[model samples]
Target: MILLGYGFIQKIGSRDFFFKVIIYFALFSAVNHVYLVVNWAIDNPININRLRLYAGKGDVIELFGFIFIFCRKKLQINFRRKSYVKIAFVLLTISFLLYFSRTQAVAAIVIISSIYGYTKLNKKAIIVISSFVVLAGGFFWYLNKMEIPRSAEGLEGFLYKIKNAPKEMFSTDINVNNRAELWDKWRSYEAKLAIEQVLNDRSSTLVFGKGIGALVDLKDDFMLNGKLERKIPTIHNGYAFVFFKSGILGLSLYFFVVIILYLKAYSLKSANAISIATNNLLSGFGLYLMFTTLVVAGLYNTNSTVPLILGFILGVEHLNNLSVNEDSDNRN
Candidate 1:
């Protein structure tokens, strides 16, 4: 997908066009999400779990669209685009909050806050802040409308997930008697097993990994049914997935690529609003990818749009560099 995005951008020869494409797709996704929510609400008015079914992996990319539009509005003085920004912000925010994904919600708040910090505070800033307050109040009101009986329902469920995040990522203790705790710690358990297998294998395996198609053995077969299958093909941790398949070398190479792209995007200096917004979007996405890898498989997750977006950003940067070089030569 990365290569495809890069090639496509090269063919199009306009970063602005690509940005618009992303935004348009995001809007389409938001509308579909709203439809899903409304349709589900009409059918299952009392079921919170049914509402959660509408959340999809595409929500993250849609979020990137929101960030792109928001930053563009903040950096540029375009009164005509204000309405579009407000509409996109409201729709995307509703879709995002409906997803109930803690990682994504955290990423959005942190990235948006960071962007807000660097930009000047004005009427636009006040509008954004006020919008957030209104949306947050609405979110809580929606939660109140739901009949949440368990810890894993509505706002309570979201808080429970946040509370268990550390244990999910690092805890070694697994309580078989408590199904909730077991499910919460599943990622950590699988990751630990993968790491143990790598270390126990031949030293050579540590360098090149078990080499794709490798499986990690869960000694107890806790996740298995009556079939006695203890080995699994994949784990949730992106780092472990890479290390398990290709060893430390592959993992290092992956980080190297991510770091290079992030730095390139961050280093891009532009007075143009679109270029500046693109630079911020790319760099913010790099940070989001780095954080999400610990739990959501990050770039390795097939559901994620990270690779495609990263590729597009890389292509834009490549073109930007070429334009810079051409100008330098012409000046000389």
Candidate 2:
């Protein structure tokens, strides 16, 4: 899909057109998400999981739209058109907030801050950082005052998830006897098991991995159906997932791709608004991918749009280079 998207962008040959298309698609998606959220609120206000079910994987594309518009530099736009873009941006943001995904929310903050710093917008950067601090403080206060539970529903459930996020990722006090405890720290637990399995193997699996379809033993079966399946084929931690299946070589290769993309994006000299936006988008996404790997499988997740976005940016860079070469030849 990534390569296909790359080839498609190159064939299009116009970055402006591609950008416009993405913007339109993003706007339409945002509207749909808002509608879903509204309807869900009216019909199943207590069931936040249902909202997630209805809006599966749409948040990823919506984040792309938000980042593009947020990082955009001065592109001449009429007042009415600019108003519409603003509305779309707001809709995207609202829908994203409703999703209650900590990883995506954190990625958005990091990406935006990185872009602001890269662009030398010190004032905006300071303001954004300050705002984040204030909001975080308020959130913590609410969590403490309300004492929200893990099984909570709706907005309270979202807050509880955020409150537990740090412990979820790193806590070592899980009770093996407690199924709920195991499920709560599921990502960390699975990663620990994967590491143990890799170390237990004394073969070349250390370097080359256990190969595809390798399952990590969870010691006990935790399937919802009460089946005797004690092994799970996938882990939420993407780095661990790759290491378990492909070994160290595969993990290194994944990092290599991210590093290369970051370098390529950083090397770009932004000569115009489009160049600037693309550079920031690519650079920020590379960083976002690195952060998300620890929590959400990052590039390995089939539902993610990270690879597609990466390929699209690379395609844009390729077209820009081609155009530059043509102009230089004409000058000669």
> Largest TM-score belongs to which candidate?
2
TM-scores of all predicted structures: 0.79, 0.83
List model 1 lDDT by residue over 32-67, tens digit each: 887887887787644445566554534766877766
Error of 1 at 234 (Å): 2.0
The residue ranges of model 1 lying beyond 4 angstroms of the native Cα positions read 45-50, 54-58, 74-82, 113-152, 220-229, 265-277, 329-332
lDDT of candidate 2 over 203-278, digit per residue (tens): 7998988989888888986674366778878788889889999889999999997776555445656454455555
**Which pairs in model 1 have colliding backbones?**
209-247
Model 2 whole-model lDDT (C-alpha atoms): 0.73
